[model samples]
Target: MAFSSPELNFHKNIGFLAFLPLKTKTSISLISGKVVALEILYRMVYNSLTAFGGQHHERIRYEQSLADAKKAGLRKGLYLGISQAFVNISLYGAVALIFWYGPYLARIECWNYDAGVVMIIFTSCLFATNSISMFIPYIVAFIDAAVAGAKVFAVIDRKSPIDYTNHTNNQPHVVRGDIELRNVTFNYPARKEKKPVNYLLFSFYIIHLESL
Candidate 1:
């Protein structure tokens, strides 16, 4: 679909020009009615290559921003690994303690050996099975999902400048006539603080021919 705004058209042109070779841009500049187009294209290329260096520079900056974040992630992973190791060691240690103490209590304290053994084993098994720390990954995933869902809801609840649903006040109707946009002042939203681009009246016109 064609854009009605000059800013949108300008951006679209820039994107299209980025993929073209230098030879193509030079050839297009030689064509008539392409002065404005070539000027915009040259500015886009200069800004992208020298000022920004396109995605290459942006990618490096993006990676640089994530350097600390990546280190933090590695640290978190290491901590979790250490925690898991401790949990495993504790589980094995509990089992060993049960085996070692059960016989001692039975022989010295005159306790029933089988009953002592059963109690230790059952208690250890219960504690190991019911521990919630084992589900750390699932809990982290749930928290992440909840945070993302809140962000999505915030965006969904926000009011937009153009509402497609409120069509009752401005109902669509057909007009049998030529439609024209004349003397329109246009400004790119990103560059709103800058001066608006003004075009003279009738400098640009759209001819809509109706059926006879």
Candidate 2:
């Protein structure tokens, strides 16, 4: 019902990201976060193309993404328009059929039809059609909500690879251990060309005594 500024900002950002292509969103997220830092290094934080590396490539990628999004939107719009049109035609056609058939049925002697019965049927049909038409416009909104809900539940139901539970073999009343690491060589994926860290070694002994 109500959201704080930070939460509102996050939702707004997520909404923006939802409209963009996945690759474009990922690239923008990855690069935009460091834009300030890069700019700061060059003594400019705003409107500095030099600090934003790979400008030409990024521009091309973003333009492609934009075009893709626009095309997708247009396609979906066409589908929605067609669906709405069909629904309107069917609904109004049903109404029109009742309008034409009700009076005809009232004139038939064998069917025992009357003016009151015809009017009731016509009014009921009209009311039902109006109600459905009022609700038809919301179908698209409902579909969007369902899609978003599915994505949220997918993330919620996913299992994490990391285990948070701790299973220590030490006795309940006493704990003692020595941990050691040696010859660890690694480098960040972003800076792999720099150098791999080597000669890293460390050891620590933990000892503790307590009541159960």
lDDT of each: 0.49, 0.54
- Summing lDDT over every window of 10 consecutive residues in candidate 2, give the lowest-scoring window: 1-10
Q: How far is candidate 1 from the true structure (C-alpha RMSD, Å)?
A: 19.1
Per-residue lDDT of candidate 2, residues 1-212 (tens digit): 01122333343344334433433433334444354344344543355655667566555644554564455566555554654565566657766777677778877763777788877876776666556555444555655555557657998999876544645533356545666679877875334444457766776656634332
TM-score, every prediction: 0.41, 0.52
Off by over 4 Å in 2: 1-47, 50-58, 160-212
The global Cα lDDT (0 to 1) of model 2 is: 0.54
| Per-candidate RMSD, Å | 19.1, 12.1
Backbone N/Cα/C clashes per model: 0, 0
Please report how far candidate 2 places residue 147 from its true position, in Å.
2.8
Stretches off by above 4 angstroms in model 1 are 1-56, 119-133, 150-212
Q: Which residue pairs show backbone clashes in model 2?
A: none
* Best by the TM-score measure: 2
The deviation in Å at residue 159 for candidate 1 is 14
